[model samples]
Target: MDMRNEATHIARQDGARAASAQQGSAEFLTFRLGAEEYGIDILRVQEIRSYEEPTRIANAPSFIKGVVNLRGVIVPVVDLRVKLGCEKVEYNGFTVVIVLNVRGRVVGAVVDSVSDVLELSGEHIKPAPEMNTSVDTSFITGIGSVGERMLILMDIEALMSSADMGLMDSAQVLQ
Candidate 1:
């Protein structure tokens, strides 16, 4: 190849590497579920609020805690602990509702507590391994390593769609 062509090719490769590095270093909004801390893409988070008693709807799924009136619009809330099959815990002080925008849908996810956002580099993230009958690992996007801790990156869209968590067909539809 000509020297000019070679130089151009090398420059393109360097640019590609820089872009990949930027994409890999993603900022995640962290939250806790039991003792384990989970992370989700920061861009997708809409808002966070302290847990409050929602207007209960009859025939709703067990995981769903019913709808909450946010300003004027009613939004369904899902208890993460019950959704993840974790043992029931008292929602006294640390409980929070993380409103997430996933695939053009807005839903509030109930979590134990909200943690500070953290940036995880590509080298720090590892593919989720097959845990095999312990936990449903399908909802996990990947396992992110932050120092000595591992944050389970949740697939928000998948979690919302699967199991029809009240947002799909709740009896009480807001007019």
Candidate 2:
């Protein structure tokens, strides 16, 4: 099946699975970056689209892949793998843009492939490991442990609004 059709299938199938999340459990959209699996709150996800080359923005950061016009709204696309300092990657059919609604703004994040939504309770989440002062891991809220799999939970809002990201100005950051 084509990527777009596959995405639609996922949305429909996963929507039902997501609705079954336990009352107090948190639902996360799991995705892969390199060899690691990461997750972000499902509420922040707007939609997922097949990868398409976006228009380049001059003087933009390398990690900022470019921008794509979604319907009438132009959304900035970010390569999460690149931004997170993962090894160089080759974009293929499995590559997809995860459109996110972050802090009232729409942005696109590129991920290798989306796994599936997972619901985890508080007990399943472990506190983020402390790192040295130079290492900034504030965006990581916690680690979700499921059976033998580990998922890194991220606060995408914080990551997109961070001063260094430059996607948001001081005014937007305040909101």
Candidate 3:
């Protein structure tokens, strides 16, 4: 092929690649856990409610703060800080519960404070590095870098649906 034709073909391929990358972009609902910031897919979030003491369940894990009734449906609330092994777990006025709907089940996650929704392109999100980390990186889908801030993108559905959480069976979640 001629040089001009080759260059035009290459430009078209680059434009297509960029468009596909943008299509993989997603929005995340960011929140604070101790000093770190984390993000989850915005589509999974049902609503955000102020922190309220939930009914304690006997034999429940420490991280499982207990369950709350949301319009008759019982939703288990998991303290994200405790689950992530944070040393400090404080519930202040800014504390809120992020209600999530995963696999037809409703659950709530306790976060220090809700930040802003971030629109991140696929290029901005990098795979989580395989290293010895304080927080469990198993639940982390990727590391999103927006400007100077780094958001730990979480796989909330996987985390909540895991057998360890006791909310749902992992096998069912996989299906």
Q: How many residue pairs clash in each candidate at the backbone level?
A: 0, 0, 0
Highest TM-score model number: 2
Candidate 3, residue 88: the lDDT equals 80
Cα lDDT of model 3 by residue, 1-175, tens digit: 4554444445444534563467677899999998899999999999999999999999999999999999999999999888888878678999999999999999999999999999988778776654433334556667789999999988898789877889887667778
Residue range 124-175, candidate 1, lDDT tens digits: 7665554435344556767788779889887676677664554544323321
Error of 3 at 74 (Å): 0.9
lDDT of 1: 0.76
**Which candidate do you rate higher for TM-score, 1 or 3?**
3
Top model number, lDDT: 2
Which of the two, 2 or 3, has more TM-score? 2
- The Cα error of candidate 1 at residue 32, in Å, is 0.8
Q: Which stretches of candidate 3 lie over 4 Å from their true place?
A: 1-23, 132-136
- How far in Å is the alpha carbon of 9 misplaced in model 2? 40
Off by more than 4 A, model 1: 1-23, 166-175
Tens digits of per-residue lDDT, candidate 2, 1-175, equal 5554444445434433443443258899999999999999999999999999999999999999999999999999999998998998899999999999988899999999999999888667765665444546667777789999999988899888888889888988998
Supply the global lDDT for candidate 2.
Answer: 0.85
Pairs in steric clash, model 1: none
Worst 10 residues of 1 by lDDT: 166-175
Work out the TM-score per prediction: 0.79, 0.85, 0.83
